[model samples]
Target: SAGLYDEARRGWLYPMDVNPAGQNAFKKDAWNKYRIECIGSSIRTWLNGIPCTNLVDNLVSSGFIALQVHSIGKNDTPGKQIRWRNIRIQTSNVKPSKADNIFVVNMIPNDLSAQEKKEGFSLLWDGKTTNGWIGAYKDTFPAKGWNIANGELSVDKAAGGESTNGGDIVTVKEYGPFELKFDFKLTEGANSGVKYFVTLSEGNKGSAIGMEYQILDDLRHPDAKLGKDGNRTLGSLYDLIASKKIANSTRPIGEWNRGFIRVNKNNKIEYFLNGIKVTEFTRGTPEFNALVAASKYKDWKGFGMAPKGHILLQDHGDRVSFRSIKIKEL
Candidate 1:
């Protein structure tokens, strides 16, 4: 059984529930041998050749045994690895039974609560503390850069720089293919963008390392005037490709606008605004290659080619607000 902290920090397994039998035999970057015996609703464990006293919920009747290899390292040792062996299981003549449907709740809010929850959809933001989120540079939340006021996460303009005080704010967790929904409100004559496939390093400085979903007041910003025709407009994949559909769906200066981004397992990316599909791009295609070549990221190899990365909220020195940030992994 691998816990959430174990998966995030040590990287052995995916985030799941766990019940330890002994006095918490797991440690970061350190191994401990365990001997355990299971009976009816009880599992006795010995940690490192020492018998210990601990109790766990015996919800499992019978199951197969498994061994896991984990990766654990800090920024200094980026590619550390772990291993395990000598795994065996003892079973009686009893057969395993299936349990009933159990719902796993998410953190964010949504409209289709009943149906989404039944289908395993989750909310990413709870409109409160930034529990599952952190600044892209530092270990804690941004002090003067972002604020959750009046049920919305607003970007503070006065605290603006390139990763100086606080850079972008990303989810503490990462994702693969998923449908992300959020609402944003932008200031007039300001520029910003939301990016994905974001990998952090002591290397790259700006947003050009990953693919960015263009978020700007296209009608007023200077960047919207720089690209070919209107290629850099709002919802047009920044400066590379242009969105086909165009509607005046953006609310004025202080009003909120709904935005949705969906990425499938086949690497198909779709962008929607105000319930209209504005852009569709298939990654790793010849057309995508051509677009990347013509764009500013021509020199970079495999710029947006990662299957998974961090979700980033940008700070372009503008007053931007976001709410209802939720995602459903496919």
Candidate 2:
């Protein structure tokens, strides 16, 4: 049996109840067999040749068999644990097959697949070079602010000042209603953001001009506390909204984090981190209006009110890298 706790700590996999100091115990009878197998998306568990349960979940497809020994206690008088045996697992040995040449022949390089094409999507960064992107300021692209290293578009900190040398970059073509997907990796303590509905002027600078999809380290960044309450944390709308969930399910620093932003023609915005939707908001809604009214964006008329605008990558002066940047117009 698993111990239960009232609240679970971040990144811990055990169920809530297992006391940190109590001696939680589990024992398996001798000659008893526990078979766990995956049939499609369901996991079937049989204990002692008797079916116990079938769990259906899309979260994980497969994993290793584990027998846990839990004990509760801090330093001296903690709880104890147990032992488990006769454990076995059955797994599919066949790897998922790749598409054949016939199906691959129709695929375009650095372009949307047929399914995505049908949805009116396209590639923003043409895997090989930066053709449709330019520095945020002036007309010429920044020579040193960005680099294509090992297929990733990486920002070098020493190359320039925050938004001074490299500035922010935007798509050459403006989009009104669409969905965007990309992979990003951030250095520890680095700061950056993705902004949309961006309007550039001679004097105006910074992401305050439009709406921002904040990219930051929630656990370490000070900006996480700069906004009203905790609304300014990573994945929230900078200062106006809060992400429903923070996906700690990120790869370590320097590893890529998949992100998705969907803005519909009707002004609905959805944010996803690593394939898990963390937040959703409808623009122009009364509830959204209330949030804006109560937030730092109260005075701005077009705060998040644009019908269409350009997509921008923020240059917060830290080393942030992006790759597999693609988009689909919805």
Candidate 3:
């Protein structure tokens, strides 16, 4: 609610919906200075004297920077103006002698940190283009209904339905035994999913079948109650195994949330909400077969038994954005 499209006053939550107009750390009718710095692979932002946004991203090594002024609206004051002063540039290295004494927000978008590179992790989503993904059913990306802007891959809102318009999208390459991480932000009453082991061979009438890490508005979506127990809820193995819901784990709607899925050499699969492990299971087990047998995927041939498959992002006809999509082969 804080960042809900009021000229960005609420502070940007993600790339798509930011209320950057009204809320500010500076005086409303006063002057302030801002400093944006990029050091090696790290980026940090400051408002007044407070640390606002900080993270490590590698997509932007060098580029032109631009400042923007919001347009005056029809319902606004005529004489109101936005101004900036003391424009400065520093090319010399400034070694920090000490740490800042304020909260630094970490918004690492579409980047691989040095530690991640050492750990053999790479970005799955390049943050600027749809290079590694394609429409789940089609050979190309959807012509409409999906958007890529400001380092976010977002599905635009449409007639609410599953795979009806832009359809689902999937990775071009298949993966086996990997650790995947992404940050997702959802609009109100949205329903989407991050799917793994997606065998594109399925010629079904709808989405290519795969095991999904369910994303939903548990408080607002009806699908939350349709699956067995709470398996269809957020962070759950959709309709098969329920994620153990933890207190203070999932952020509320409209705020960014972190998701993790790991499949190991031993064929062990684990899911996480934020950084907490919420579900775990082994693949191709008798118990796994029995669970799939009782679930909605009972009719799909060889469900969840494939050795490797593409990852997918479901378009549930609601606005949802994803960023910092990175993965590491285990």
Quantify all predictions' global Cα lDDT against the true fold. 0.64, 0.63, 0.77
Off by over 4 Å in 3: 1-106
- lDDT per residue as tens, model 2, 216-318: 7767767887877677776778788877664354556766676778897778888766545667899889998998888766877656777777788877777
TM-score: model 2 vs. ground truth: 0.64
The number of the candidate with the highest TM-score is 3
Put down candidate 1 lDDT per residue, 102-206, tens digits, no spaces. 222222333334434555556677777787888775678777677887778877775434444346788878788988877788887766677777766425664
Q: Residue 297 lDDT in model 2?
A: 66
lDDT measured at residue 326 in model 1 versus the true structure, 0 to 100: 77
Per-prediction CA RMSD (Å): 19.4, 10.1, 11.9
**Cα lDDT of model 3 overall?**
0.77
- Angstrom error at residue 86, model 3: 43
- Of the two candidates 1 and 3, the one with more favorable lDDT, higher being better, is 3
- What are the models' TM-scores? 0.63, 0.64, 0.70
